[model samples]
Target: MYKHALAAAAAAAFIHLPSTAAEVVTQWNFNSLPADGATGTGTTAAAIGSGTASLVGGATASFASGDASGGSSDPASGDDSGWNLTTFAAQGTGSGTRGAQFAVSTAGFENLVISFDLRHSNTSARHELLQISLDGISFSDFALFDADAGGDRWYTGRTVDLSAVAGASDNASFAFRVVSAFAPTTGQYAATGVGSSYGTSGTWRMDMVTLSGTAIAPVPEPGAMALLLAGLGVIGTVVRRRA
Candidate 1:
């Protein structure tokens, strides 16, 4: 009875253990504003982020905003192609820049969840995309194009849903990211000057980019089934010995 009781507890602790949803390994904010707004705390800045226009050559992205004076990050003049590192920025919120992008490194992730806030300060700030990947080599697309990319303008807080991208997988190690860019570059707007960048006169901002989730390789459960199998093997050996 005592042995069985101990086994029960062991099984409960391991198999039924409470799970903690994975959370941010790291995060950043470009809102360089001081923890407390005070005089001489550094003003005249964009109070948002490094709104520079470039490609994701290969560099890590920070969600929190900071002083633009030394704010911008690397992969600077190049593009964002390297793995693991990524960038999320759309051109002019209300002005002549319209774009967005999603990227990720599949090597370090399997099952994961990524969340972030965005400011569609203008017409060109909307995006309808969420990128999901497993093994970084295989990826799935979650297109939100049917809905307004950035949602209603003047709207400052919005999150991209990755379920569409993940599709169907009980659990898999993976990373989820976003992709957006200045579109409407052609068509009637091509000659008429109606491209997305030319839509209005503003810019957008991203805050709180977080990646959290567990690598989802199946783990064997230590339970009665396992113990029973072991016992059955032992019994079979004994019968063979007797024979």
Candidate 2:
């Protein structure tokens, strides 16, 4: 009976739901743009996976390619290459700040996961923020971390669970923004804001942005399920023989 129970659970793990592809919802390789540094003023739209990837930024922000220290994690220059951020403005100016924004529609998705790779060319500690929005206009804070600490191979990776923010909306328009710290007060660091020193010369790069989720509960492949069932059967037979 005990062996039988284990076999049942194992088989259950392989039970598949109907029409589950587990396809990628959205992805951005950024290979379409030129390798040289170019500031993005308008929206750069591309069809990715099952949705459209819209890359946009303000007047101060643009996408360029300069950081070479990312090594293998950094995407190579190709036909469909990766997009890098080149923030070349001071923060806290309100009007003359620089950041990168990506907007997309995540409809009919559940248990979503959002991830990306980032690298920076900062000489000192500068903070950058990752924000999310349900509507494209207003953004709420999500994560704040050091964009570049000037270490070896400073390329960093982040993965966020988007289950709560995504909810169950068919036309849920989601947006993500990476912004440097704004102008500082009497007692503040230049973490989020790109300094004037940076304004003249500083850069950030990003690549391999992806969003994925399952519409239905995940199950093992048919062949895998069959194998699991067979293994469980073998275990049960062995247990009975021992008893």
Candidate 3:
């Protein structure tokens, strides 16, 4: 009886084990490999995993220094670059319409989370909106970031948690965007700096874009299932004999 109880307890413990630990599903450091010594040169390809990074809403992209304006969260010593984006809509136009987008497959993962480092120019939009899409077509707003501290400085570790969105988990068409948004109440764009005016030429630099989640546990193999069933049978036989 004691052995049967022990076996039962062990099975229960194994069955109730927690989900797998969170892992980086995709990441883009935007830094050049091999220390190219040129901050103006980098790749948009994901540094850690497979994904696509693209400009959205008429925004143009170029590589810029990640070590400028007190630097980003990147630890690379040389050739650390960030994606510099510009060509925003003119003042009082295209609210929430211009910026960058990244698409990644989130299959077999759950509890989605996204993070990035961004630098807003003094003349850039003060309000930035984060949007997500499960179908890769229609997007819904998820979070809004205010660069109230002014621009020409780094804002590291901007994060959005999507653990509550059931469709975000294990989806093949997961995508997200960060776009310039109108001010909360005014319905007009505001400049990042205290006295600066919003402009189409202002830039937004982005680095360390990352997506993470917990991997879904795999189903038990046939051999493992057979072993478990055999163990249960032995435990049942022992209990019956003792009774």
Candidate 4:
């Protein structure tokens, strides 16, 4: 079976759950303030995807701040750089291009499944890459699968997966890194709109992002629970007096 075959099927079914807690985990999508280096800001109120990077791909990455239903747009500038998105242009047009997005430690989500959805037609290259990371600082490439080519054109879509990053429990963070790594003159890379500064941009466009993961279960770092109980009692007295 195609590596993404399951993802596409799973993608359809995964959106409705609470997404707050689960073994699979995912970005419920937040559409407000931008996640630093993304395309838009917090006011947007749109969810980009799970993981630190924008589920979408680009040069200046795109990220939303809300969930699946309500979200805003995330733009890609230069300043923000943790888990970001960038683009690969061709000739003068960005049509024949590739969208590159990633997961960052700062955005949230720790060790879990992470995947990217892509639409490829006549890919010049065989292996397209979608990977993950533990610290927004370091990176690790995970999967290699062929981009599905429908014709000599590109389409739009999303990507999701379970990641293989390390130290997830301790850091409580991870990142998704995307690169138009294999720069072939023609093929999926080209068809999807990612060519050199001079090649005929192929055709890659991506929209929609999400991040879903069961945050590292609250272990309550040593005795924190005891302190929590004490704090609650104090608040309880205040409520009684107000009543």
Per-model TM values vs. the true structure: 0.42, 0.59, 0.87, 0.43
Which of 2 and 3 is the better model by TM-score? Answer: 3
Candidate 2: stretches off by over 4 Å: 1-23, 33-47, 50-67, 72-80, 87-91, 95-97, 123-125, 151-154, 166-170, 182-197, 216-243
Compose the digit string of candidate 2's lDDT tens values, residues 1-243.
Answer: 766676666556645445545556777655544433332322245436644544334423345442346532434443323344553444334322346676767666676676777665542226556777777778777776665445223444567776676442244677777665542342233532344234424555656667777675445678887787787777678777867
In model 2, the Cα lDDT at residue 114 comes to: 69
Q: Write candidate 4's Cα lDDT for 2-32 as tens digits.
A: 4344444544443233344534344323233
Per model, state how many residue pairs clash: 53, 10, 0, 93
Which prediction has more favorable lDDT, 1 or 4? 4
**How would the candidate models be sorted by lDDT, starting from the highest?**
3, 2, 4, 1
RMSD of each: 11.4, 8.1, 3.7, 15.5
* Highest lDDT model number: 3
**Full-model lDDT, candidate 4:** 0.40
Candidate maximizing TM-score = 3
Judged by lDDT against the true structure, how good is candidate 3? 0.90
> How well does candidate 4 match the true structure in TM-score terms?
0.43
Give each model's whole-structure lDDT. Answer: 0.36, 0.55, 0.90, 0.40
Instruction: Report lDDT (Cα) of residue 105, candidate 3.
Output: 95
